[model samples]
Target: MNAIIVTGGDIDLSLLESYISKNKYTIVISVDAAVKKLEETGKLPNVMVGDFDTLADEKRLEYYAGLGIEIVRHNPVKDFSDTELAIDWAYKRNITEIVIFGALGRRFDHTFANILMLRKYKKLGVDITVVDRCNRIYVKSNPFILEKRLVWGKYISFFAVKEKVFIESLTGVAYPVENKYLDNIENPSLFISNEIVDDYMSVIFDGEILVVESRD
Candidate 1:
């Protein structure tokens, strides 16, 4: 089954509703302020995890608890992030895939950390993707196909997370490459702003690469 972990970050309400309606997410876990966001949508999460620092309203807490939503409250001084705790809860249930919402926000550190979490969990054989208003990010180290139909946005960009990444073959995109090594971080647009020309794009690469699909 697939799980969705909602973080307390910037979220587009319409987009969140779209995902909630269309996607058959078996486990819905909200972290901290995201619980309120989910509540605003008139839907309840299966489980809520957080320290309740930001959401300190007593009545609201009782309201969700009254609805039988399992609330996993933690200490404010805990080491792990609220979102990380939510991921752990969902992953422990033998979930096959995890999609994170509200990961991108005003805070760059939180957003970047959420992106890295994708790579960390993907190594554990869990298919994880971080989705927001304009981007869908995940780390890929194997050959994969990025079809236009399933692509998150019109443009796809690749950011190397490792020291060096060697792309073996790339096709079906506007700027196709073969046997190219992306090792430098100097140029930010080295493998960015690419679009699928035809029906799909194929990428075969070595080392960790953060594949970013954006509306631009």
Candidate 2:
């Protein structure tokens, strides 16, 4: 099944609205502060998951309860992070493709952790994406076709999240590379910005490839 997952990182409501309006998904799950974002946007999530630590006020918790939102609260001392818990919950329900919003532009550690978390779900054979106002980030395990869309982005970046990823073919990009190996680098700016030129692009790789479609 298809689902949209919103994490508690900084979010852009206008961007979120555009995505939701275009996609007809089965469910929407919010994590932590994303619940409040949904409230502000007049969009109710199907499920809300998080430990209430990010929320400062107790009244906010009560406010959610008053709205009859079913919140799955985890212990503050749990081993898995709240975002992990939310992903686990969705995976248990057999949700395959997940589009995540409000997942970037916050604490660097948290953002980095969540990006790595997306890789953990790769073995499950599910398509997961972490999105924000400027980018749609995802991990690619094998060869795939990417369609070009006029989103709020101009540059595309592909990094080998694992050791190395072999690119089979590329099109619709300014600096297109084919049959190349993207090695894990200390400085990732080498693969930071790329552009797409055609209607679609193809990427083939063996290990994990983290693709960031960004703007500016």
Candidate 3:
């Protein structure tokens, strides 16, 4: 089953609503301030996990408790971020796919850290993705097919998360490549700003690559 974790960051309400309505997420978790935002949408999370430092309303907490929502509290002094804790909780349940919302915000540090969390849990065998209004961010180390043309995010870009990443093949893109190498040592400008020219696209790569499918 898949799980969606709502985190404490800037969220695009329209996108959030679109995802919740169209996707059959098995479970939904709210982290700290996200609980209030999720509730504002007239929907309740299945679970709430966080230190609760940012959640100020005492009555609202009581209301959630009364509804029998599972609340997992953590010490504010802990090492992992609230979103990480929530992901760990889902991992413990043997969830194989997780989509994170509200991961991007005005705070660049937190946004960067959240993106790195994808690397930290890369070996957990879960397909994790961080989504916002204009972007879908994820890490890849193998071949995958972009099966359909995205309606929102039109441009696809790839960055080498490792020192070097060898792409076996890139097709169905405006600027296609065959057995290309995207290494930090070389000029890494070739892989950015690619657009889908066909019904689908495919990328096969070696090593870790960070993919951002986005639009203006």
**In order, how many clashes per candidate?**
0, 6, 0
Candidate 2, superposed: residue stretches over 4 Å from native: 56-68, 150-152
Return the top candidate by lDDT: 3
lDDT against the true structure, per candidate, is 0.86, 0.80, 0.87
Provide the RMSD of all predictions against the true structure, rounded to 1 decimal: 1.3, 2.2, 1.5
Window of ten residues with lowest summed lDDT in model 1: 181-190
Residue-wise C-alpha lDDT for candidate 2, range 88-120, written one tens digit per residue: 998999988988887686588878988888888
lDDT of 3 at 6: 95
In terms of lDDT, the poorest run of 10 residues in model 2 is 185-194
**Candidate 1 wrong stretches, greater than 4 Å:** 184-188
Write out the backbone clash pairs for model 3: none
lDDT of 3 by residue, 163-209 (tens): 77888889999999988789877957778889888898988888899
lDDT of 3 at 139: 88
Sorted on lDDT, highest at the top, how do the candidates line up?
3, 1, 2
Best by TM-score: 1
The whole-model C-alpha lDDT of candidate 2 against the native structure comes to 0.80
